[model samples]
Target: MQFENTLSFAKSLDLKDELSDYRSQFHFPKVNNKPVVYFTGNSLGLQPKRTKKFVDEIMADWGDLAVEGHFHASKPWWDYHERLAEPLSHIVGAKKEEVCVMNTLTVNLHLLMVSFYRPTSKRFKILCEEKAFPSDQYMLQSQVRHHGFEPSEALVEVAKRDGEHYWRTEDILAKIEEIGDKLALVLIGGVNYYNGQVFDMQTITRAGKAVGANVGWDLAHAAGNIELELHEWEVDFAAWCSYKYMNSGPGNASGIFVHERHLKNDKLQRFEGWWGTKKDTRFLMKPEFESTHTADSWQLSNPPVLSLAPYLASLEMFDEVGMEKLIKKQKLIVAYLEFVLREIDKETEGSFEIITPADRGCQLSVFLHGQGRKLFDYLMENGVITDWREPNVIRLAPAPFYCSFEDMYRFGQILKSGIER
Candidate 1:
């Protein structure tokens, strides 16, 4: 689709967008009596208008039903997390039984690693991409240390060449082969947080398996932002937070996927909890742990119903729009953003360089050569809500659900002004 760097053209595109009505479902932050051009959905998604209604229903149920709300609430607090499984499965491309909405991302990562990250004297090393999200880095480092191995020996990172901004797929695949049988786990982010580059999870998973390693992905950025086929890709396990592109709200419950192959594997070691026991006999208070042959077996405790209420509201929107339609708009909006950024670059004689690759989702990370934080502050003062990374990168993500083409055009104008001033 050809794009023009004009407000009229932006408005024309917005008029033709089928998903334009979705913008009303969210509440955008305001500045100077108008909604700011929000582009940080990659960090924290705008809250849905229906979130209040969903939470209120839970509150009312608790007020009237009290203890009985566990079984008698409108949605039934006892099995609230189960209601999200089907929709969450569709989003992550997994069987309904294979997906569970449970703990936060890092917590779930540790839980899954307990089962999948089995290290030994012969095959104890873990391979991952360089500069993974800090939380993941910490988790991997600590996990290896807990297993009585030095991180310098147990953790292997595949990095880009000296001058490059993103890792090449061939390089990553080669590293997996290089590590060979010594590699026990292959864990990496599906999308890099700094560069916004989506990894080739399918090829990476296949390569890791070929070398006898259990593969997993941190889908914090990839889950709602890109098309994922975790089950088809044969990924051993994966976890993601709902606060970002999933738009569930701040620090909301996360979703987990365990391939059906692992569901009934009784030999798999995990940190067992009472909530993971078979529901039928769960209340019977049996001392023996009978695992629920599904991803629900990973649950440590009953879910927080209030925290999940917003997620249910957001997942309903995901179900209504569907990922295919959302991705279509995603491409158009991101392409337009790219075009506008290029136009800005040309106008300013290449004032900034976009470090993000073509294989990214909604985000584009811009490296402002010599001009540092001042330009970022300028845009923020003028009401453009973009993300900034230290050194010299500004991250912009025009979420397809609510971000309009006009927002893109205005961002270009604001960016141009900031660059000039």
Candidate 2:
């Protein structure tokens, strides 16, 4: 379909949209009197209107019954995170038992490393994409250092070909094969945070396994945003924060996946804790940690009920819409967004350059080559909520659940005005 940079065309697309009604479900910030055009769901999602009800229920339970809420509350705080496993598994494409909600993203990565990142005398190197999210870069560096190896010696970064913005799948696989026996683990951000490129997870996992290296992904921008088959991909483990496309609150709980093959394996070493023990035996205060024979084995502490409340609220919506429908809408909406950017780029004398590749999710990281910080400031003042990086790049992520065609159209107009004026 040829897109026209007109309100009528955008409205026509919106009228035919099945997911458009979801826009009303979230609470958006207002500028003047109108709701801001929110494209920063990649950073933090808008609050769901239903989120308050879920949180209030937990607050009420705590008020009515202090310690007893663990067993007596409507949802029961003790088993609260369990309810999320089934619903969240649908979002990330994992079996219910293979997925678990736990600590923050980097923390979970460190914990999962205990099991998957075991380095030996021969295989001590870890391979990751160049310029991974700083937290992940730091995590890998610290892990390798803890094992008594210099990061320069143990960390192998696959830099992109000289001028390319995205990492080529062949380059990554070739690097994996080249690393060979020295490679202990292959961990990368599934959807790159900087360029919005979706890595070929299945193929990469295969190559890593063929090389006898454990494979994992930091799905911070992948889960709930892309089509993931973690279990079928035979992924050793994966972890994702819930705030981005998942629409959970800021710094909320993180979801994790550990393949079923490892669930029953007791020989693997991991950081064990109280909540990770068998559910029946959990309250008994047993001295020895007994595996629940599930991903719960990686859990270190009790579920944070207050934080999990918002996450579970957001996940209830995911369960209702399902990732299948979400992805269906994402493909069309993201394409439309890309089309709008191209149309605007032509109108503005090619001031915009999209760095995000075709294999992106909801985000489009555009380099404003001919534009500058003033334009970014204008966008902020004009109620277009977007994420900005240094060197004049704006990461616009129109989450399918709330973002509409009209938002894209309006953004194009705002962008044109920002460029010309």
Candidate 2 minimal-lDDT segment of 10 residues: 1-10
For model 1, the run of ten residues with the poorest summed lDDT: 28-37
The pairs that clash in candidate 1 are: none
**Model 1 per-residue lDDT tens digits across residues 83-167:** 9998888889999999999889999999999999999999999998898899999999999999999999999999998999999
Q: How many backbone clashes does candidate 2 have?
A: 0
RMSD of 1: 0.7
lDDT of 2 by residue, 1-421 (tens): 7877789999999998888888999999988788999999989999999999999999999999999999999999999999999998888889999999999999999999999998999999999999899999999999999999999999999999988888899999999999999999999999999889999999999999998999999999998999999999999999999999988899999999999999999999999999999999898998888999999989989999999999998899998898888888888888988898899888878897899988889889999886788899899899899988987889999899999999999988998899988
Clash count of each predicted structure: 0, 0
Clashing pairs in 2: none
State the displacement of the C-alpha of residue 144, model 2, in Å, after optimal TM-score superposition: 0.3
| TM of each candidate vs. truth | 0.99, 0.99
